[model samples]
Target: MIPGQGGIVTRFAPSPTGRLHLGHAASAIRAHDFAVTRGGRFLLRIEDIDGTRSRPEHVAAILADLAWLGLRWEGPVFQSQRLDLYAEALAKLDAMGLVYRCYCTRAAIAASLSAPHGPEAVYPGICRNRPRHEDTDAPHCWRLDVAKALARTGPLNWWDETAGTIACEAAAQGDVVLARKDAPSSYHLAVTVDDAAQGVTDVVRGIDLFAATHIHRLLQALLAVPTPRYRHHPLLTGPNGERLAKRHGAPTLAALREAGEDGRALADLLRAGRLPTGFSARNA
Candidate 1:
């Protein structure tokens, strides 16, 4: 249990691949405010599972940016350091027959997408029915058995501040990746395990991650871990009405910071107009 906290715990999990942008700032502020308002713990988890692109410099930059914005977290737990924890969770799922090795290649999945337009490229379950090989020397990614996972689990339910009562049945979400063949672990496995480790009971993020909640809930059921309440804020958009990303050059927090802009002023801009009153998570 989180010390000195009542109700539920919240966390801000960020990928330290680039400088914190306006979208990130909004999410951070919302999460910070939510935790403080409810007298709960506000935690931070650096999503550095993608070792190829993640860097220590980027992680330090994230911490510095959050600090400058007055968003203090319990810690800066690096996901890279928690690979063993994720592996343990994956092992548990495997032992329970909820997860299986997926031999399908990305290219094949993409090709299959063209054959029949399905809901969000649902996994064809090519490997779902295949015999689980005890010894596989070749490369393979691990995927959860959505059918069994659903049978063992059930329809997932979560409360979103903006969207309101987001629900999804297991049949719709389908099988999801837990770990990658290239990387040691996938986002789902790493995030679910990390949240449990950090004792996070509430998740504050962007609506862009809303769909991912289903996968998270499924994992929680398979691992018998408690699911956290969710709030997906609206994503910050660019002049073209697209989600703010590394591709957008101007209006970037790094650029503005370099121009000697105050963190508070930038935070105001992130709100898009008036300073958000009464604490609420925005979608991104």
Candidate 2:
């Protein structure tokens, strides 16, 4: 369902792989404000897609961080609990010949990408043609047939509050993984399915996910699911001007709390992109 068509229903689906950081607080507050302003429902879904890395303690810590920030959610729907739903969706696409098994290994793809002029590493449509390969009998994940998906979904275009009008053709993204060789679901498949199931109307997130929007849009059409309004906020950057990532050493909320940092101060720092003590390099 689209925002403005009805009351908004937003969500903050954070994977509890690590402790929540300042960036998490920013997105949470923005989502909460949007929902509160419109009297919409705010949902908190635990996106623990990578079970190998996610822990119950991490999820509990995330819930605590949100509570500390004064952001309450309608739920704690763990993505792990909804594997069956994702499997059913994949099966439906597969039955329609819109899903196929792929057996390409990551090392093989890396070798191809390293070649001078090899085919673009974006799934090269390898499995698209060899739909009945022996790999289908072996271990394999599923990928959506872009041609059939586009035919079913039509063209996609949406307006974003921060990024303005955006449109993308399915062909540009190429065929993407719907499920992993090791797991029944991939990020793209599970997210789209869960968003539709939860009736998410507005998707507010960091700009890093901007490129993935096209893939998600394609899946929305393939599933006949209603598209949500999107708002991609500016991302938090590190001191070296690189996008913040888990491996880069994040300052966690629990540590900050132990250091006696105020949540309101963190909120203000997020809004202004500066330290809460009012020291500004630009102003200086």
Clashing pairs in 2: none
**Candidate 1: stretches off by over 4 Å:** 1-7, 113-120, 268-284
lDDT of 1 by residue, 1-284 (tens): 23467666788888877787777788888887788777788888889989788888888788778777766678778888888998899899889888888878877777766576654678878778778655375798888888887877667676767667767655566678888988889887888888877788778888888888878877877787887778777776665567767776525556666777788765655545443232223334
Against the hidden true structure, what lDDT does model 2 obtain? 0.77
Tens digits of lDDT, candidate 2, 1-284:
12233378889999878888766787888887788678788888998878788899988888777777766678888898899999988988887788888777766656656455434356666667773745546777788878777877677786678767788666776788899977678888999999999999999888778778888888887778998999888766566555555676657787777687777667756666674332222210
Each prediction's TM-score versus the true structure: 0.88, 0.87
Q: What is the C-alpha RMSD of each candidate to the true structure, in Å?
A: 3.8, 4.2
Which candidate number maximizes lDDT?
A: 2
